[model samples]
Each structure stands twice: as C-alpha cells, then as structure tokens.
Target chain A: MTIRLFLILGLAAGMLVADPQPQPKLLRNGLGQPPHPQAMVIEKLRRMNPEERERVLRDMPAGRRQMFERRLEQWNRLDSGQKKKLEGSLESFRTLTPEQQQTVRGLFRKFSETMPEEKRGDGRRMLARLRNMEPDERKALLSSPRAKARFSDSERDLLAEMAEKLPD
Target chain B: MSPNTMSCPLQSGNADVLLSYCAHMLDEERTELIEQHVAMCAECFALAEEQKTVWAALDGWESEPISAGFDNALFARIAAAERSSAWEQWTAPVRQWLAGDIGWKPALSVGVACLTLVVGIYLQNPARPVAATPTVEIAAQELEQAERALEDMEMLRQLEPTADEEKRL
Candidate 1:
C-alpha cells in the first residue's frame, strides 16, 4: 500500500513538472493582415538605389546572407499557409539568444545543404513545426534513431544541444 | 493655404532649384517663387527642409577651396588612364601567359620527353636504324678489322726488318 502511494505521488509530481507545447503565434494572436512580409521586402528593395542596396547586402554576415537568400528564393512560391507558419516560427525564433539563433540558423543551413531537393520543403516545414513542439516531443524527435541517422554528427549535436537548452 | 502658396507654380525635376533655394543660392525672384511652392507641397517642403538641415550641418565643417589647377589635374588623370589602358591592351596576351595555371609536373614531363626524343634521334645512326641487329654490326665490324690488318701487314712487309732489330725496335 505504501509503495503504491509513493508511485502515485511520483507520477503526480512528474505530471506537474511536464510543460505543454506553446501555440503558434498566429493561433495565439490574430492573423497578420496585408501588406504581407514578402511584398513589404520587395517594396523596400524597390526604394533602395543599387549602391545603397549593395551596401546593405555587403553589411550582412554570411549566415544572414544564406537566410536572406533562402527566404528570397521562397518569396514568390510561398503559399499563404506557409507564410502564416513561417510567421509564427519567426516570432519564436526572435525570442532566442543570438548564439541560439546562430546555432539554429547553422543547423537549418546544414540540413538544407545536405538534404535532397525533394525533401527540402519537408525539412523546412519540420523547422517551422519545431517552434510549437513540446520540449519532450522535440527531444524525442531529435534523439530518435531516424534523426540520428539522417543528420550529420555536428548538426545532430547542435539540435541535441538546442533540445537541452529549451525552457521548461 | 498661405496666399503665396495659392498663386505658386512648380515643375518636376526642380530638386536642384529647391536645393539652391535651401542654400539661398537663387536670386530673390526665383527664391521667393520656390519658397511659395515649398510652403504647400509636402514632398518639396520635406526635401527643402532636409537640404536646409544639410546646410546647417555643413556650417560646422570647414572645407578648403579647390586649387586653380584642378581642371588640369583632372585632364592629366584622364590622359594617364588612356595611356595605361592602351599599354595594357598590347601586353594583355603576355599577362595572360604569365598568369596561366598549367601544372608543372605533367607539362614538364611532356616537355622533357619531347627533348629526349629529339636528342635521341640526333645521336642515332641512320645507316644502322634501331631495328638493325647488334650481332650483325659486331660481325661486320670484326670482318672490317681483319681486312684492315691484312692491308697493314702488306704495308709492314714493305718495311722489312731483322728479328733482333724488330725485337729491339
């Protein structure tokens, strides 16, 4: 009877400590209206002269350049659903520390560089999904054998490290 | 609107006029006309104000006047650039040769092999092509030496000498 009582108490404590996954920004807040992000960027680009635009691009670091290029390539093709999903994820990403941001950026960059073209869209979608996953679910997904086999050692390690640093 | 703005006229591409107005560079007549236009148009008014601020910022910064030789210096630079460009056009091929990325090992090996082939051909006897048997050459050489010895013996007999003299000689 005492052993069962201790087990029940332990289970209750574990449940209390467990954190639920965060809702995506669009779901938590209202959907953003136009002018949409892509149009806003295109409008800003149109306003800049060649020299001014070149200077801005030159000032961006390599990681940001890759990020900008990736988003730029997707700008025209991004459906409304994908835009809403990215918007939510971007909101969560803004809350990360600079080091964490770089780690996430590098990890995504590595994933994109190594993935086959057909799988790339799914890989990007997975990254967007990560912003809303529960800590334990993220840990399970990252540590799964399939993920271990798929990503390179350095990329997997960065992800595992990211998992460890997640707030409860 | 102000009375001046009501009767004003402005045209596009008059940014230079606005700038001159901002700097008080225009004559009183033109300046007054632009000032009246600036009072009404938000865009031109903002530009004039921004250029006026630029003038204010420049007040604290002192700059030396251009030297009288500035035009001569500019002409000299253009001439020098033209001369250098002409010179570069002539030397472009030579520069390209000097900058070629040919790897040495394979190129040098081919060059050395070609040189060895040329030298080997020069040294080889055409009468006795490489395919001619070595044994045949040695046999012909020996027969020729024997024939030469026979002729020399005939010549030696012509200088006949005694055995003791031959031994002493």
Candidate 2:
C-alpha cells in the first residue's frame, strides 16, 4: 500500500513538471546563427598548430575547394559597377565585427519586440539612407550635432511638402 | 516486295508536280495520294487511327444544357436593369448640364475687358517729363560737398588705424 502511494505521488509530481509551459533548450553553435565559417575558422585556426591547420585546409574536399575557387572567380568577374555596389554592402558588414553584429542583432530583436508597425517604414528609409551614403558622410552625419539638428527640420519640411502634394 | 519496289514517284510523275499536288490543301489528287499511303503504309495508318480517335473524342464531348429558367431570368434582369439605367442615362446629362461650374466664359470676358480698359488708359495718357530739371550750379555745389566729406573720412582713417593694427603695436 505504501509503495502504491509513493508511485502515485511520483506520477503526480512528474505530471506537474510536465505541464504545457515551454522549456529552454541547450544553445548549440551554428544553430539560429548566420553561416560565417571563415570568421569561425580564423578564430579556431589560430589555436591549432600552423602545420596542422595547413594540412586541414589542404586536405579539404576538392568540391569545397572548387566552390571557394569559383566564388573567387565570380568576385573577380564582377565589373567596377557591380564591385562598387557590393563594396557598399560589405562596408556595413565591415563596420560590425562579429561581436558588434551580435550587439546590433540583440538591439534589433528588442526593438522589433517593442516597435510599432507604423514606425517600420521610417526605420527602413533610415537604413536605406545609411546603406547608400558614403562611409565618411555617414560617419559625419551620425557624429555631427549640426547635422542632427538640421536633419529633423529638413526631413519635416520635405515630408510636409510631399504630404500636401500627394493624392488622396 | 523488294527495296526497288519502293519507287521514287518524282522520277515517274515529275517531283515538282507531285510536290505541288501535295501542297494543294483541298485537292482530290492530294487526298487520293494520302488515301493510297494510308492503305499501303502501316505508320501512316496508325497516325490516321490516332488522329481519328482524338477527333472522335472531341466530337463526343457535349456542352451542358443551360437551366430552363435561364432565359426568363436573364430577360427579366436585363429589362429591369435597362429600365433603371434608362432613368440614370436620361438624368445624367441634365444633372451634368445643371451642376457644371461653367465660370470660365464670364471670368474670361471680365478679365479681357479689364485688360482692354487698362491698355486704353495707358495708351491715351502719353507720359510727360517733369518741368523742374536740375540747376547746374546747385549740382556742382553738391559734388563739391561730397568730395569734402570723402577727404574728411580719409583724414579720420589716417589719424586712427584699425583695431587689428593697434592690437599688433
């Protein structure tokens, strides 16, 4: 009779623990993250012996080596115009190293959680402007107090004028 | 039959004439040739059979009949719609004519009349010069005064140098 009571109690306790609330799982590398193998490899490869690292790289599958070679070839084939566009994109990536990328990602995640849908368009336009601007110009615009003061005035005037002219 | 039995019809009937006969879309000669080929060739006979099957299937498909009430319903709807639309159509032009803001003609006439009056007045009044022209002696005296003032200013400047020069000294 005592064993049956213990078993019942144990079962009740298990059921209580197993209620529908979602539990957090162990975080794994490469899960829910961008595939930036080059950065990862560089970090780890430094710890490995130079000869071992060289051997590992040399012994990489022919297909993967060919893929990397093809990527380089494709990069080389891009015209100056294409290169300039790609450089504009890469400039953003270069601004954030992996650690900064994580910080930015966390900030955006929080912002997405809190931000209203109406302000999304403003954010997109801001990002587009940042992406389009030259590096020095973007830096100056962000850093300059005068630029910040003028930005709102000019933007407001432009928006007001556009609103007046736009069709219903 | 031997391979040579497969005779080249061109050598027998002139290739161009035979080709032209074949090219004739509805000619009896082309029909006869096709019939003969179907009778003799297994491949053409099979193709004809396949085509006939397709045509037979197409011919077999019958369109579903429309409902018995369809014509009556359609006619009733069309008549009612026509009656309502007739009223709308009849009123539309009247409404437009009455409601239209046709201000341009009167506005334009007034604008033109005002413009004409202004032009006429300007044309009638030939502009005249003033009677009291400058006296030569008074003008010479004013010029002399202006020269004296300039000299005085120059003397003041010579006496007191600018702040920058004073600071340097």
Query: What are the iRMS values of all candidates?
Result: 52.5, 44.6
DockQ of each: 0.00, 0.00
Candidate 1 lDDT for residue A47: 45
Inter-residue clash pairs, candidate 2: none
Tens digits of per-residue lDDT, candidate 1, B102-132, equal 3345534644664555455444533434343
**lDDT by residue for model 1 (A1-168), tens:** 344345445544543333222211222213545433323343344345656445545645777555554444444365566445444444455467878756655554555466566544434344334435876787677677877777656665554554444322
lDDT of each: 0.51, 0.44
After superposition, the stretches of candidate 1 with alpha carbons farther than 4 Å from their true spots are A1-41, A46-73, A113-155, A162-168, B1-169
Residue-level error in angstroms, candidate 1, position A106: 3.0
Error of 2 at A75 (Å): 77
